[model samples]
Target: MPKKAKAHASRQITLSELVTIQAGYPFRGSIQENPDGDVKAVQPRDISDLGELSADKLITTNLTGKRKADWLQQGDILFISKGIRHFACYVPEDMPETTLAPSLFLLRVKPEYQGQLNPEFLTWQINQAPVQRYFDNSAEGSRQLNIRKPILAAAPIAVPDIETQNTIARLYAASLRENALLHRLIHNRQQQLNAIANDLISHS
Candidate 1:
């Protein structure tokens, strides 16, 4: 591999290799709602948390069956099939033991490929420049762009070697965490500085 490749190049694997299959998000009106039940549906805004799904992200489902629930698993990945093209992020962690929400496609990987693709890495890649471009190109609607399975599967994937992919995944995950921590730290320091200024002003 070239030198720059080490920085950004990946093995480029087929979508079929690392993915099991795709599930479409149900239309908002199509999701069966229960008046007495409590389920917090996840929308595009819920894809953050370093690409991890939060417990509150689970939405209510009127569908009564085990198979539909099986679509979400501990390590299964959630991808936004609609909305902003570049907003196609993945859920990094396990799905909460709750009803899976609609408007997002769920991609469950087999146990054999667990370590091959990290949810965080895949999420970052999906939101990256190249893949985002594919989504932009594939989107066919005026309001919210719609991304089909073919578009996702055929999107050029620059999957580097396993080792490199692992590194990239780790780096991606760590950077987000560190950035969040840094932001909090900065906020706290700012508050302290403001307090000190307030004391000086009061004394003066």
Candidate 2:
């Protein structure tokens, strides 16, 4: 028989206390894509509903002005604050020199809380039903619901011990991988069926 997991003590705290939330890079005017650009900018569409951020095919652009750039780092959490659906995703260690668009918020775990709070755990917590409901209720604007910076910073998060957090984060990560694999399998199967149908039509 498998060993049962032990429950760990947890405490509820506001997000601001755990991480420093910063607004995304404020790119001026229309985003002009440059294939030769050095930096890659992540847009709201680049992120999936399952908290996966695609680094491939991102908008590449150069900054001409004097605006300082804050590059996205590994373990960083990107949260969608401008859309009706607020989701959080963790930046993988394989990320390159990338910056997020203004529609998102960059959350970096505070140095003091870094050891105590895991980025993946925090990302998972932010996407949970209860926290999502909080965001949904507090979101403003008529045409499009938006979660203000203050509101996002003030959102509550349950923090457990580092060990427990790591375990949960690992499980969540595995689930995401499994989900992606299943999607690919389904897509390939559908393509196989389509190919068979096309062959039958040609034969007929």
**Winning candidate number (TM-score):** 2
Task: Note the Cα lDDT for every prediction shown.
Answer: 0.63, 0.88
Question: In candidate 2, how many Å is residue 49 off?
Answer: 0.7
Q: Candidate 1: misplaced stretches above 4 Å?
A: 1-10, 24-40, 49-67, 88-93, 111-115, 186-204
List, residue by residue over 98-175, the lDDT tens digit for candidate 2: 888888999998999868889999999999999998998899998688999999999989988899999989999998
RMSD of 1: 4.7
Pairs of residues at least 3 apart in sequence or in different chains that clash in candidate 2: none
Q: Roughly what TM-score does model 2 have, to 2 decimal places?
A: 0.93
Tens-digit lDDT track for model 1 on 1-204? 545533655577655567765664344465665655544445556666345444464456554434545335555566777676335445544445344445676666557777776655666677778877778877878897777777777777666667776777788778877977998899999999999999999999
